[model samples]
Target: MIDEQTARERVVSAADRLFYARGVQAVGMDAVRSESGVSLKRIYALFPSKEDLIVAVLRHRTDRWNAGVTDAVDGAGTPRERLLAVFDFLAGWFREDDFRGCAFINVFGELGGGSDRIAEAVREQKESFRRQVADLVRAAGGPGHLAPQLVLLAEGAQTAAAISRDPDMAGHARAAADTLIRCALDDAGEPAAAA
Candidate 1:
């Protein structure tokens, strides 16, 4: 028999796949059991409720999202490139066959009002993202005001790409980000910093 951790991982993975493809409310415990190949009793033992499973899935997705962004930024050679690498990451993610936009955003929109735990999880992820962008902006020598604008561009790009079914949205957002970075640096009287 699989260990509890392994079983829990399987259940969360299965639930995440189902919840992302279909709405969370649309997927039930039976579907999770079927998708996970774990017994219903075992699944319940691991996650007492669907809400518990949902939180675990959100945590899993957040880890992945954080890792992807960190990897993209780490791969870049300069601070400016690192900032833009976020959009590059998004572009590749958008091209994936199963891309369904941001999971955090999707879940928040689905159950933000009624679920305090889920809402808090979503808020934490978003705040974490804003903090990351702010750090990248500081490293790139951008003014304080530039971070929020860049965050808006990145967030808007994801929503637009998902709804409009256009992966090119990343490219468009990237271009806009480049312009913003350059302009912000120029406004700060450090035009060369963007380079």
Candidate 2:
């Protein structure tokens, strides 16, 4: 018999794959059980409900997001590059064979209005993303106001990349972000920072 934690991980992993590829509403518990190789009875004992499972999956996605973006930013040599690394990360993600856009956005559109818990999960993830961007902006010597605009560029790029099936979307967003960063620094009267 699998331990509770192990089983829970398996279930969430499988559900995340299915839900992101398909829609959350399109997949059923039976499919999760099948993909996870855990019994349906055991799945329920672990998740209690589909919503519970989705929450777990969102948590998993958040973890992945944090790690991936952190790694990309860490590889950069400057705050400016670090700020742009976000789009670099997105470009890599977009190139993946399983690329399907932002899972949080996907979940939000499909079920945000119906479930408070799910909406909150999505909100938490998005807020975390915004905070990450804001921190990068600060490090790059950009004004506080630039964070939201940079975020919109990144967010819109993700959507456009997914819809257009084009990985270059990240490059486009990065160019726009570069322009914004340049202008923000100029407006702040700060000398042009190294890229």
Candidate 3:
């Protein structure tokens, strides 16, 4: 028999795959139980309700994603490199066989604007991402307005990769982002491109 912690982890793991692959609304608790190989009673004991489990899953995924992006950006040599690194990360992620689309976006689609908690969580995650990018741009000495444009380009690249399965979108996104960063630098009366 799986321990309580193990059962909870299994439930979360199973739900993560299913929820991301399919949509949150499309996957039921029964499916999670079966996929996790845990009994329904144990699942209930760990998570009081499906919505509770959903929240947990979203939080877990958000944390993992944020960590990944932080790592990717931090490893780069310059702010412009860090900014473009985001697309590189997405390009690689979209190539995975299990990759579908953005989990947060899929969850939002599932909820259809109904759950305030889910909506808030999604908003917070996006806002964090935006802030992270903006801060990186500011630190790199980019103009104030470049952050928003870079964010849009990053998001657009993700959407394109998700729909078209083309890693080249990352290159295009990088080009656009680089152009914005250069413009920002130029506006700030500094070298327009990072070394």
The alpha-carbon root-mean-square deviation between model 3 and the true structure, to one decimal in Å, is 1.7
Candidate 1 local lDDT, 88-195, one digit each (tens): 999999999999888888999999898999999998888888999999999877899999999899999999999999999999999999999888877777757447
Worst-scoring 10-residue span by lDDT in model 1: 185-194
Candidate 2 has its poorest 10 consecutive residues by lDDT at: 186-195
> What does each candidate score in C-alpha RMSD?
1.1, 1.0, 1.7
The whole-model C-alpha lDDT of candidate 2 against the native structure comes to 0.92
Clashes of each: 0, 0, 0
lDDT of each: 0.92, 0.92, 0.81
**What lDDT score goes with residue 171 in model 3?**
84
The residue-by-residue lDDT of candidate 2 on 26-94, one tens digit each, is 999999999999999999998898999999999999999999999999999877789889989998999
Clashes of 2: 0
Q: What's model 1's lDDT at 104?
A: 88
- lDDT of prediction 3: 0.81
